[model samples]
Target: MTGSNRPAVSSGWGNLLSGANLVRSLALSGGVALHAVNLYISTTILPSVVREIGGFDYYAWNTTLFVIASILGAALSSPLLARAGPRGSYVAAVLGFIAGTLVCAAANTMEIMLAGRFVQGFGGGILLALAYAMVRRVFAEPLWPRALALLSSMWGIATLLGPAVGGVFAELGFWRGAFLFLIPAASLVALASLFVLPPRVEKRTESKPLPIVQLALLTLAVFAASWGGMGANLSSTVVGMVTALGLVGLVIVTERKSRHRLLPAGKFELPTALGSLYMASALLAVTVTCTEIFLPLFLQELHGRSPMEAGYIAAVMSAGWTAAAIYGSGLKGDRRTSAVRAGPVLSLASMATLAAVMPWTGADGDWLPLALICTALVTGGAGVGLAYPHLSAMILHLAPQGEEDKAASSIMTVQLCATAFGAAIAGLAVNLAGASSTPDDMDAANAARWLFVTVAVAPITCLVVMNTVSFKGADHAS
Candidate 1:
């Protein structure tokens, strides 16, 4: 599976797109799409939900609790899959999602909505984890890059559907309907799973006990960061972040020493390939959150755009990512290496560009600034896309013996954790810069500058960390 040993040309898209694999592919991609679209829909309709339910102070908690629950669900996926089998696990996840969506649809208060969101996030996390874990179980090695790319593309699809669905429902004064819409979508995925997925894994083994201690530490770390970011002042936010970091360090140490491992062995040692890959992946994921979570707000408040317009504009980043991922999946050898190396560079430049331009208010007729903003968004997204599939493949390639399922499931865990951290950091940056839920133009501008500038460090650090990842003996072939 190394670069030198792999075929120059893979089985090609046809192999994955046709026959029995096609149904399986749909099942996997559909799971991710369900999760992603729900995310976008929730984000878009949240303003309306708050306006109606009156939990403006706890706006961020919706995402915070959901993501924390998602981390737990992701950690639990491997064991669930082992015990329940593919079909059962997928069905269980879908049922959970449906239940949560129903709860949100019926919620009369912010507290109820937060509870529903937590349940929804847990199911979404399991869906995401199972999709990645099944990639290895169901497909040939040659198709992994393409499969991963396809899964990544679901975000792009969500970017298109989420805003429209949420916007329509919100505009029509029926935001609850938006949550209701997810029920049928999830049911279809469950139906497909019953038909397409195997009843059980072929070589199933005894399930390991859950890593309770490490899970507790990881949960505390994310919760601390999230709670801190929600603090009323900067000092509390800093303390929360510091505490979160300390908790994360403790988790790393505990993971290293524990027999019931959450991540693969050597994951904490940066010099090791697995360690470097995980670090690079986490950093790239962090860069994404810094801009994406707040882009619509900045566009609407500062640039005088409509909600729908801002939503589509924000989606340009996902479009770029999808295009680049599809293109990058076809590369091999030196070209692939070049693409990987270029990812962080592009992201860094994009962040820097945003830091400069996003803070400035433009004239009514000024389209140049808008153009630059779109360009930067695309560049940053493309950077992550180009490198992500290759990095994922490398991790799977380098995973320790008999731990492949854990490695695959942990991909979602790492991503969710990074996203939570990034959101927390972005919250801190914006709050410190005086951007509240309803900020004045100047406050919004300052928040934009501070947020992008602060997040710019992620890509820079990713660039450094990625360089240390030796691709020797790693798979790069599409």
Candidate 2:
């Protein structure tokens, strides 16, 4: 259903922060916070997990499977919300998350850990989608922007607390405790949601039919890529990657022809402005997943940093994103367009810098390489931050008149799909470099180098594709 077309009231952040709105705000944002924090926590503790369970080969699979399951959960969110209502949906999601966390805490094998992650991701995805979906339902029109900003800020908070909590547990050689730690927090959020959120939406619209075939195709594509990465030889990797590419193409074609759509019209056509924005967003998202999925491992292995140090260092990227997005949000006219174009340039430079320096085994007591790594991480993340807000705004403004909601929802879907694929590709790179099978320093170094180099292509491709995205009418939208 589309949002109300009524003109927004002239309300400010104060309006959203006072009275009953305050409780509603906390309830909604808390759901997103749980999901975001869990994601960062998993990333921080993954290296420690592999060390104990000995499945370095499937390291990236943790992220890949989680994200794929998340996509499915997100796709099902609307139906769940319509059937179960906000309080019920929130409680159900929390139960799933708690179950998954318990399984993770008890897991003795990498396979079991992966299964837990998949379940956790499904719950997290539903929580995330519900938070965003409920905003339009619960908040006044004037409060939408403020509510969204508050929700988005949860990721920034996650960056701080997630690493600290997960890192401490990993440092203490009790990585499983990190998973268990989430249980109480999630329970509290669920309790708050049950009390604060409405049992049902005032206006219940029928949920649209799911794009099951397209989603299945997308999932297969990621699995195919991951499978190839796990293969013993280059030929197998080639065959797997090619097969994945074919499946992706089929997904696009199927979406184009299908009555049940995943994205708005023209989203798959690069010549269209909406299509270009989606492509640029997807490409930037890929760079993010590629870096985040492996950064902690690289830092711990290559720099001999402790888990706490590596986790904190990895979080610099999220800090940069939060800072830059706040700054970029205030830009206007030519300045905004410039920020959009500059995003890829900075990302390209950061990726190249990472490729060059990440492989180096620095001298004892030297901190220069680490400094450069952090700088590159910040720049890479800033690249996305500067461009993403504007891109999203433009997509909303330019979407087919009747399909704005579809366009809005598809943005998150596209991001999750790209993240899943990026993780799979990164696993392939690390495996091909032989880093997963061996503990050799050089192999790890080579894996770091090749991974950065491979993901560098995303920004380079974004650079070329972004230029075609015209800003002629974009300013009006902003």
Q: Which candidate leads in lDDT?
A: 1
CA shift of 379, model 2, Å: 1.7
Compared with the true structure, the alpha-carbon lDDT of candidate 1 equals 0.86
> For candidate 1, lDDT tens digit of each residue in 1-478?
2222334444478888888779888989999998899989999899999999999988878888888888999999988988998889989999998899999999999999999999999999999999998887777777888888899889988999999999999999999999999888888889988987889976779878889999899999998998798657768777899999999999998998888888888888898889888888878867776688888888988889887898899999989888999999878888888888888899999999998988776888999899999999999999989988788878877778777878888888998888888888888888778546456643888888999999999999998897777776565334
The number of the candidate with the highest TM-score is 1
User: Candidate 1: minimum summed lDDT over ten consecutive residues — where?
Assistant: 1-10
Candidate 1 clashes between residue pairs 3 or more apart in a chain or in different chains: none
| lDDT (Cα, tens digit) per residue for candidate 2, span 1-478 | 2224535554466777788778888888888888888988888788899988888878867877888888877766766776787789878988898888898889899999989999998998888777766765666654554565566567767989988888889889999999999988888888888787788855666777888898798889878887786655779889888999999999999989998776678989887788889889879868876787788788888899886678778878877776777667556689979988888888888889998998886899988999999999999888877877667656666768655555655666777778777777887788777445555544788888889899998888888888777787644332
Count of residue pairs whose backbone atoms collide, per candidate: 0, 0
